[model samples]
Target: MTESTTFNFIDSARRTVKLEQEAVGLLSTHLDDNFTRACQMIIQCRGRVVVTGMGKSGHVGNKMAATLASTGTPAFFVHPGEASHGDMGMITPGDVVIALSNSGETSEVTSLLPLLKRQGTQLISMTGNKESTLAKAADSHLYAGVDQEACPLDLAPTSSTTCALVMGDALAIALLEAKGFTAEDFAFSHPGGSLGRRLLLKVENIMHSGDQIPVVSPDTSLPEALLVATSKGLGLTTVADADGKLAGIFTDGDLRRAIDQGVDIRNASIKDVMTAGCKTTSPGMLAAEALKVMEDGKINALVVQDEGRTVGVINMHDMLRAGVI
Candidate 1:
C-alpha cells in the first residue's frame, strides 16, 4: 500500500476515537432524572440485570454487563436472538432488562420485548433514537445518541456503541454509590485475586505457630538465639519469659550491636541485649495490615500474641511468600 493509504487508515482510526470521545463528553449534559431513574431501577432490582443487544451493540452490552457485575451491580448478558430461541427463560419477574440498539429498531432485540413484559421484567432501553419501538416499549429509556458515526458510510455502530458503554458505566457507578458499595464489599466478590488476598488473608493464616515459631527463653544465650533465628530464617527470634509471654526480641540488629560492642555472644543472655518492648501483632489482624505495621515501625518481623502470650511470629518475608505484600 502507498504511504497515503497507510495514513488514511490511521486517520480513520483517530477520527473514530475522536467521534466516540465527543459522544461520551456530551453524555454528561444528558444526565438527568432519566439517568437517576435508570440507576434506581437497577438498584431496586431483586434479580440480575439482563443486558441484551444485537451485533456491535450486543458486544458493548456484554461488556457493560460484566462491568456492572464486577463493580457491585449484579448483571449478565443475554443474546436477544438467543432469547427468541429459548433464552428468554433466563428472565424472571424480579430481573431488569437493559436493551441496546443504536437505531432503536433492532428486530432481534425488540422481538424479546413482549416476552420480557409478560414476565413482568422492567425494561431499560439504550438507543440513539428516542422514537424507536424499543425505546417506546421500555419502562425507562437512556438515549445514547451520537450526532454522527465515525464510519465513512455513517452506518457502523462505533460512536453509538461507545456512548452506550459509557452510559452503562454511569448507571453502574451511580447504583454503586446508592448502595454504599465499598472496597471490602468488592473484595468479597473477587476472593481469588490479589485484592482478595490483601483483604482476606490475615496474619494468623500465614504466621509460624507452635513449634514452628522460633522462640527462646530470656535465659537463652545470644549464640543460641542467633542459631534459632538462622535456622528459622525469620531474621529474628522472640525472647519469652518463664511464663511463656513475650518479653523481648533478639534480631540481626542486636547481633550487629553486640559485635560492635565486643560482647561475648556465647555468655551473654538474649534478654540482656535484646530489644525491649518490641512491636507485636495479633493473629486476627489482616496480613496487609500487618505489612503496614511493619512498614510504619521500620521493622521486618513481628511477634504474634494472644492475651499477652506469644502464639506465633511473622516476618516481612512471610508476608511476601503469602502474596500479602
Candidate 2:
C-alpha cells in the first residue's frame, strides 16, 4: 500500500480509538448514587445477575455477564427474545436484572419489563437515554450516554457500546471490591487459565518422582551418578546418604568442573564432585515459586523435598514442558 494510504488508515484508527476513549473518560462524572445503588442491588442479589439485551447490545450483555461471573459476581445472559419465549424462568425474585439498550426503547427488552416487575426482580438499566421507556421502568438506571458514535454514519454501535461495556465493568468491579473478592477466588472461576496454573499447580504435581527421579548415594561412583542423570535426562542427580537423606546435588556443571580439575570420573565418589548445600524446594510449594527459586539461584534444576527428604527432582526443562513458564 502507498505510504499516504497507510497513514490515512492509521490516522482513522487513532481517531476512532480517541473518540471511544473520550466516551469512557466522561463516564467517571456520570457515576452517582444510582451507580452505588446498582452495586448494592448486585451485592445483595441472592441469585445470579441476569443480563438481557437485543442485537449488538445482546453481544455486549453476553460479555458483561461473563466478566461479572468470572470476577466473583454470579451472572448469565438471557436473550430478550428468548426470555419472552420462556427463558425468563432463569430469573427469580432474588436475582438482579441488568438490561442494556442504547436507545432505551428496544422492544424485545422492553416487552419483558412487566413480567420482570411482576416477579419482583430488581432491574438495573444501562442506556444512553434516561427518558427512554426501558430506563423509565427500571428500578435503577446507569446512563452510558456518549456525545456521538465513532462510526462516520452515526449508525453503528461504536462509542455507545464501548461506554456500555465500561459501565458494566465498573459495576462488576465495584461489586467485586464491596464483596472482598480476591485473586484466589478469581482463580477458582478460571482454573484453566495461566494465572490459575501458576497459583495452583504445585511442584509435586509436575516433578519427577520414584523411578523417574535421578538419584545416587553419596558413595556412588561419579560414572554411576552420570548414568543415573543420563537415564533420567534431568542433566542432574541428587546425592543422598545411606539413610536416604539428601546430601548434595551433582549436575552437568559439577561434572565439567570435575573434568577440568582432572578428577577421575571412573574412580571418584559422587560426594567428592557434587555441589554441597544444594538448593531445594518443598513439594507443596507452587511450581511458579520453584521456578522463581531456580531463576534467583541461576540454576536449572532443584530437588523436591518433603519432611527433609528428597522425594523428586524438577528441572527448568520440565517446568517449560509443563507450561509453568
Candidate 3:
C-alpha cells in the first residue's frame, strides 16, 4: 500500500524547476553598474569579444559567444585548455576577454589571465566566486552566484549555468539595442536563418514578372483566357486595359462558376466573367507578410502593382519555395 507513493518522480522535477526559476529571478537584482561596465568594455573594443572557460563553464561560454555574435556584438569562444597551446595566439590587442569560472580557481583559465593582462586587454569575469582569484584580477566581475544548486546533490552546475546563460542574453540584447541594431542589421548576420528570410525575403525575389505574368485583354474570349492561365501555370490571369493597367482577374474558380451557369466558356468576354479589384501587393513587401495576406484573404495569389500598373504576380507556391511558408 505504501509503495504506490513512496517515490514521487513528478515532485522531483517540479522542485528542480522551481529552484531554477527562483535562481533566474534573483539575477535581475545584480544587473547593476557592473553589468553596464561589462557591456561598455565590449562595445568599445576594436577587436572581438573572446570568451573562455573550462569544464561546464566552458559549455556555457560557447553558448554565450554564439548569442553575443548573433545579436551584433562580435564574439567567439576559446577553450581554456587550448589557450595554453597555440590557440592563445588568436587573442590580439583591443580584444576583451570574458572568463567563466564557477569556483574562480580553474587553473587552466587563471593561467592565461596574466598573459592577457600584459597585452593591455580588458578582462571581464563571470563567476560564482566573486572573492576568488580570477574575480579579483579582472577589470569587471559579474556575479553568477546561486544560494543553492537545482541538483539534488548540489554538485552539478544547474542554477549557476542558467544564471550565466541569462546574464549573457541580457548583455547581448542591451548592446544590440544600444547600437541601434535593426532587423536589416540582424539579417546580415543570419542570412541563412529563418529570421533572416522573414526580414529580407521580398515578394519580387519570388514573383513571376515580365512574360511569366499571364495577362489577357478585357475583350479576350474566356477560352483564350483559360489558355493564358493554364499555359502560365499560375491558375489565374490578369485582365489588363488598353494602357496595361489591371482591369480585373480571371481565375480557374471563375471559369467553373461561369460554366455552371451555362455562360459559354468558348465565347464569353473576359471582363464579363472576371473578378474586379483583385487584391494586390507591392514587390517590396516581405514574402512572409504576403503569406499572411494570402491566408487572411483566403486567396492563393496576389498581383504586384506599382502606381496602378501590373508589375508581377506572387502566389503561395512562390512563398513556399522561398521558405516564407
Highest-scoring model, lDDT = 2
Q: On residues 1-325, what C-alpha lDDT tens digit does candidate 1 reach at each position?
A: 8888667677778888888788899988877777878888888889999999999998999999988998898889999998899998898999999999999999999888778887799999998998999989998999889898878788877777788888988888888888898877888888999999998898899999988888899889888888998998788888878877778998898889989999988799998899989999999998999999999999899999898888899998898988888
TM-score of each: 0.88, 0.88, 0.91
Q: Model 3 misses residue 20 by how many Å?
A: 0.3
Q: Per-residue lDDT of 1-325 in model 3, one digit per residue for the tens?
A: 4876788989989999999999999999877788989989998999999999998899999999998898899999999889899888989878999999989989999999889988888999999987999999999999989999999899999999999888888888999999999887888899998888988999889999999999999999988888899999999999999988898998887888898989977779999999999999998888888889989999889999987889999998888788877
Ranking according to lDDT, highest score first: 2, 3, 1
List the lowest-lDDT window of 10 residues for candidate 3: 1-10
* Native-structure RMSD, model 3: 2.4
lDDT assessment of candidate 1? 0.88
Taken over the whole model, the C-alpha lDDT of each candidate is 0.88, 0.92, 0.91
After TM-score superposition, what is the CA distance of residue 237 in candidate 1 from its true location, in Å?
Answer: 0.7
State candidate 3's TM-score: 0.91
Which structure among the candidates has the greatest TM-score?
Answer: 3
Give the lDDT of residue 284 in candidate 3: 89
